[model samples]
Target chain A: MAGTAMTPYAQLVGPVDVYVAPYGTAEPAIDAAVPSTWYKLGPTTGDQTIEHSGDLEVFRDNDHQAPVKVTRPEEDLMVTFTVVDMTYEKYARIINNVGRIATGTSGSANVKRLGFKRGATPTEYALLLRGSADSPYGLYPGQNYIPRCVQSGNPAPARGKATRAELECEFMTLEDDTQSSDDDKMGWGTVQIN
Target chain B: MPMIDPIAAILKLISDNTNVQAIVGDRVAGKHKFAQAGSVNAWKADQSCIVAKDDPGTTPDIDIGDHVGRVELRCYGATPAAARKIYNSLIELIRDLEGRTTANTSNGTALIYSLVMDASPFTTVDPDLSIDMVVGYARYRIHEYALEEYQ
Candidate 1:
């Protein structure tokens, strides 16, 4: 008996939750591990790229026909999302890298001061993205990357328009030798496809 | 056979429990109210309430063909004691139903397997508290045959 062909609807859904661990920490199996703490980012999109190099070789026996050989490449993962809330905690990674934050309290007055300074050392961080709700899928970077804030947009206020800020970030994915299991190193991070 | 909405059945089960109703009263307008997911914003202070939201669940079991899913039930109250009381009552009610296979027939959904509390309820201060309020979350895993598998 022949079975009817049905469209596979196992597509990944949105409203991804982002988790971060200190740089250089070995990534845990994201599918089975719940992040200690995570921030929900949404109305978002994800992008991935693979960098490859190829060489052309011509042999006398091949009669001037060049054979192209391609090598497996590097993977790049990037995500851009808007940050509606401008709280210091929401921008901790960027602030910690590019600025200073002072914390103190006196006489029922709590103070949190954020300021920019030069010569601050750039910090790297490991990132993981999990699908929201009942979707059992996630994406993680194999290794920590020095996050570069490629773009930071100022909040724009307008008549009949909502004011929000945007942050564009890029991470250079690198091979992690710390992972002992080949299964852990499969794909860009340990993504759960089920 | 007609299917039952799991959320509705669970809510009805809670509503029918005398112990839960004694503390939280009737659905939305009671000493303690019950709402689903994002509707907890309407809950008032001094009123104990439980908010249920769907959680990311694990994969289905291959042998029994049952899919286990989690529901995060957040109990909120003006005081820690009140929150704990409501959470305890709900926990006991859930425990009492362990091994029971029959659903509220009125809800028309048969229980495929028992519902179990995944872990002990933990308390925390409400992050969005205007007044001092305590919140506790209990995770429950419900087992049911996946309809997609049948399809």
Candidate 2:
């Protein structure tokens, strides 16, 4: 008599691919094929961090030492990764699309420049992460989708060495009220193990 | 699991270079000093030659199976000036070492992602073997994905 078989091959373990597009769109990434308007943030140096957090309300009694119950009212989802492929577009995205590019001829040598300014508000994007599929866990590649996401924290790219200059960026998702269900508001994925 | 032969890769890096071949004339080989089945006289007939052998052990990435290793290069010639010529050719060859995918220069399953010399080539003596030789060390970084791609 055999029990549940170990499914190592079905485990989702590999590099995650990050993609981004404009916000408020119906579907930016369709059938795992990124649209022309979308941009794939190139090679990341290390692991992609997926974090899920929520505001917990603990009900405590005056006489009791421990809390009775804890309830979560709001939840947040964030993903962080370091992009190694240095490009004007990656810089602009980390800065929430404030930067712009222009070309000019400087003393007979054609030069392209990426320029940006301060006080500009952040921009929203439809973030898509294509992770490996977990067959036994019934998790698919296209399921992890965030309809509205905005970059969070300050981005500092350290330069120099045999190591490539990497821009570390973190993005937090916003609730998309247009969706019918709560699960569809932020994003959906089975990322837990018990 | 077959590992990459850094010695062969180093030898290929030298033998495949036109400038080095011009100096040593296809006499580049492994640490055997003579790969052909011949007597010591036959081996020394074309005394101007280059040989390479890898250092024992490796330093790999913590998680991934990428290997970081070193290879020692030996340049032998009949005269001191001739040995220096081979060393000079190696110096010129090292200019194009960065960002090289070993698939392009793989002589026999020796793959490398990148390479750089530890320092400038220096002179070494072998009175017993009786030859003028110069020695240098090259460090190489080989990624696991490159080997997986080959598989």
Interface RMSD of each: 12.1, 12.8
Name model 2 segments beyond 4 Å from true.
A1-4, A27-32, A132-143, A161-163, A190-194, B1-151
Residue A153 in candidate 2 has what lDDT?
Answer: 58
Among these predicted structures, which one has the highest lDDT? 2
TM-score per model (chain B): 0.67, 0.76
Q: How do the residues B1-151 of candidate 2 rate in per-residue lDDT, one tens digit apiece? A: 3445556666776787899878777777775454345655245634788878776565655744545678778888877778888888887777555233344334334345556678677786655566788888877765433233333
The segments of candidate 1 whose C-alpha lies over 4 angstroms from its true place after superposition are: A1-9, A29-67, A72-75, A95-99, A104-110, A117-120, A132-161, A181-187, A191-194, B1-151
lDDT of candidate 1?
0.46
Residue range A1-194, candidate 1, lDDT tens digits: 01223211222222344545555544455445445643332323334222323343433434445544534344433444444445555455443432356688867899876664413344555555553232322122122122221222222323345634544344334345455654344224334344
Q: DockQ: which candidate is best?
A: 2
Return the clash pairs for model 2, or none: none
